[model samples]
Target: MKSRIHPVSRPVVFRDRAADSAFLARSTVDSAKFTEWEDGNTYPVVDVEISSESHPFYTGRARVLDTAGRVERFERRYGGAVRPLR
Candidate 1:
């Protein structure tokens, strides 16, 4: 362990705008904004676009990609130039 060489880790609030969720956690990330938490204390507010609350995988709403269709489209456009592997 070293002194005066480590980042300051403190409680910060991560806000997920899409899911409207906010939580407090300790992090070393820096932010210029602040907000009062539920405990009536001010903490740095970090706005995030995606979190567990808003992530498609966590919410079980992930979209399945049609790989076959995409491959077919690519082949249609560039199949003539690409030589078949033997």
Candidate 2:
């Protein structure tokens, strides 16, 4: 392996505040925030909005879309002039 060419990898903590969970992993990214892990070690912490913990697919919580209501509103506004594509 070449030396002094690749980005250095360090142990960092990825925190998912929405799910109230965190995990330690090695990455090249760094953060100003720091946190203590369960293993009794302090590492740089990065706040993430979504992860496997809170994701819809992983958590099996899909968002229900209001498709029918939207279609009715569009038709009422445009007088249903927009015909369906053949």
Candidate 3:
């Protein structure tokens, strides 16, 4: 196989503004800001709006819609028998 050329992967910081969380990972993304990590090393900082820390799915803050209720309402109005399909 031919030699593969890709962007250099370096240690970078991803910060979630809403949850005030940050993590260090290797990425090729560029950033203008830098922050000192626990290891006493500076890495490029990238600000993000959402992350696992603040995401509704990850934090269990998501809203569950009443879709089942809607289905039941439709069935009642249409008078359809509920059947179980194998």
Steric overlap count per candidate: 0, 0, 0
* After superposition, candidate 3 runs with Cα above 4 Å error: 1-4, 76-86
lDDT of 3 by residue, 1-86 (tens): 34567778899999999999899999999999999999999999999999999999999999999999998898888765656698
TM-score of each: 0.72, 0.69, 0.78
Pairs that collide, model 3: none
What tens-digit string does per-residue lDDT give for candidate 1 at 1-86? 99999999999999999999999999999899999999999999999998999999999999999999999999999988998899
Q: After superposition, how far is residue 33 of candidate 1 from its true place, in Å?
A: 1.1
Which portions of model 1 miss their true places by more than 4 Å? 65-86
RMSD of each: 2.9, 3.5, 3.6
Better of 1 and 2 by lDDT: 1
- Candidate 3's TM-score: 0.78
Model 2 pairs whose backbones collide = none
> Residues 9-85, candidate 2, lDDT per residue (tens digit)?
99999999899999889999989989888989899999999999999989989888999999889888998677789
Candidate with more favorable, higher TM-score: 2 or 3: 3
Q: 48 in model 3: Cα distance from truth in Å? A: 0.2
